[model samples]
Structure formats: C-alpha cells, structure tokens
Target: MNTTANHTSPPAPRVSKTRRRLPVLILAALLAAVPAHHALADKNDHIEARELLKRGEIVPLARILEVVQQRVPGDVIEVELEREDGLWEYKVKVLTPTGRVRKLYLDARNGVVLKIKDD
Candidate 1:
C-alpha cells in the first residue's frame, strides 16, 4: 500500500493444436495426391498403348527397333512412343560407332522413318 502502482498486461493469444497442424496436414495430403494421380495417368497410358498394339493400330516396338537399326546402324540407347496430332510416333536414340548420337523419329503405324537428327 505504498507508492507502488500495479501494471497488468493482457495475456498472449492462444492457438489450438489443430490450427497449428492444419497447414501441415493439408500440405502432406497434397504431396501424397500428386504422385497417385501421376501413377494413374501413367497406368492409363500403358493400357491404351497395349490396346493399340493388339488392335494393329500401332506397329510393334520390336519391328520399329529393327527398322531403326537397319537405317542408322548403331547401338540403340533410348526409345519412346508418343501420340502427336492424332498420329503416333516413335523416337529412337542411337549411339553410333564414331561416338555420335542420333535421334530418329518414325511413324508408329508403318515403321517409316520420318526424320533424323545427328548430334
């Protein structure tokens, strides 16, 4: 009861545990979903490719490789099939004996070489 004055400050705001964990949970869920979606898309693409092959719509990869080897005469390294503008194409990468790389683009339906690029 002397000349001392009481100074009372407001308490700090409280944050619930759920509120703090919400952002983390949302981020984790998003990260988990992306891979599943990508995997599903990949599986679908594979099924479609198999169906096309069975229907004789697209040439077999083995035949395409044979055609490519006959034309380029190299060790085939990589190959990919793609559908562009409603037409299927095969991209083949070859490593030549002279240590050069060549990219060959072919028609997937007929195994016809459409274009070639050397590197």
Candidate 2:
C-alpha cells in the first residue's frame, strides 16, 4: 500500500491582483462619479428654488395657477417652470371646457401672463 500521503499538497487557489482590486476599484469609481453627477445636475438647475422661495424671488405656484385660471379659463394639464433670457416663467398648458388646449407663459415673479398659444 503506497499510502505516503500522496507526497503532494493540493494546488493553491489562483488569485489575480486585478481580481482583488476589482471591488475596491469599483467602489472608488462610484465614489468619483457622485460629485461629477452632482455638478452636472447643478449646472442644469442654475436656480436655487428654495432660496428663491425664501427670498420671494418667485411667487407661489398656487398664485401662478390662480392667475393662469383667471386669464385663461381651463383645467391645468401640464405645467413647466422655465428660465428664459433671465426671466423666470411658468409655461402652463390648460385644457378649456370647450376642449381646447391653450398654452400660457407667465411671469413667475408676479403671476403675469407673458404669452398665450393655442395648442
């Protein structure tokens, strides 16, 4: 019986340095992406809405809606806040009772209608 413990040890598991660093590298990559994402998001939203609200730079959305309803009688279907040529405007789409879609652009600061378009 040649039971000499086989005179050999089991082969060692393969361990690539890259494999060991993969998780750490992935975490690092994710961490690096967060700040860049934030920067891009910030660029798109140049206005600090909360700060504007606190400083009264813009009127409340309810007031804007009221003004819109008074100017153009309809149920609001879509609303968008857009800053154009240094003007903060609310682009509102209203569905009138007569089944007409009217687009209204208003000054967000004082709830004044800027333009009206039939859609």
Candidate 3:
C-alpha cells in the first residue's frame, strides 16, 4: 500500500476586483456630481435671496453701505451682497486704517460682522 496523502492545492488567492472598483466608482461618481450640485445650490441660493428681499429680512443696499462706512470710518470702495454656501451676506470693500484695501462680510439680516479680510 503506497502511503501517499492526497495534497489538495491551497485555494487560489481571491482577487476582489469588484471591491476595489467600488471605491473608485464611488469617487468618480461624487466628482462628476459636484459641479451639478454646485449649480443647483447656487440657483437655490438666488431664490432664497429673492425671498429674503421680499420678506424685508435683508437690509437695503444703500443702508448697508452707509452702515459699513460709519462703522469702519473709511471710504467704501464697493458694497455688495454676496451669497456664499447658500447664505446671503454683505461684502464691503473699504480703505482701512493703514489705507489698505479690506473686505468684510456682514450678516444680511442683522448687520453683524461675519468676516473681515484686510490687506
């Protein structure tokens, strides 16, 4: 009797091609969706701005300019309301204490300073 034990070859290494592709596919889909999502978000933000204006929640453009000028005590080169991340806010470009251009963002509803970027 030949004592030869049957040696079963180890199972082949599993190559999870689908699993690897899943993350890649998800990333590609998200990248492709970003621009479309941004465009829709912008459109919605515009609608929100119109609604806020109708509701009188936003200060008048001229009034905002006056307030910024009064508070900053400088010449305002430009005053405009910008929508960022779907929220409407004010941006004031002013010449500040050192005579350098500065940009500030204020809350549209309450006139509170949200941000100030100075040169």
Best by TM-score: 1
TM-score of 2: 0.59
lDDT of 1 by residue, 1-119 (tens): 68988889899889775575455434322222122224334434655666778888888777887898898987666666766677777777888878999999898789999999995
Worst 10 residues of 3 by lDDT: 28-37
RMSD of 3: 18.8
Q: What are the lDDT scores of the predictions, listed in order?
A: 0.69, 0.65, 0.60
Candidate 2 per-residue C-alpha lDDT over 1-119 given as tens digits, one digit per residue, 9 for 90 to 100: 77667567889899875575455434322222122225334432434554555688767666877788899886676665656677667777888889999999888788888899999
Candidate 3, residues 10-44: lDDT per residue as tens digits? 99888674564455434322222122225333334
Score every model by TM-score.
Answer: 0.63, 0.59, 0.50
Error of 3 at 16 (Å): 75
Tell me the lDDT of model 3 at 50: 52
Highest lDDT, which number? 1
TM-score of 3: 0.50
Q: How accurate is candidate 3 locally (lDDT)?
A: 0.60
Instruction: Order the candidates by TM-score, highest first.
Output: 1, 2, 3
lDDT of 2 at 10: 89
Off by over 4 Å in 1: 1-41
Q: How many clashing residue pairs, candidate 1? A: 0
Candidate 3 regions exceeding 4 Å error are 1-52
Model 2, residue 53: what's the lDDT? 54
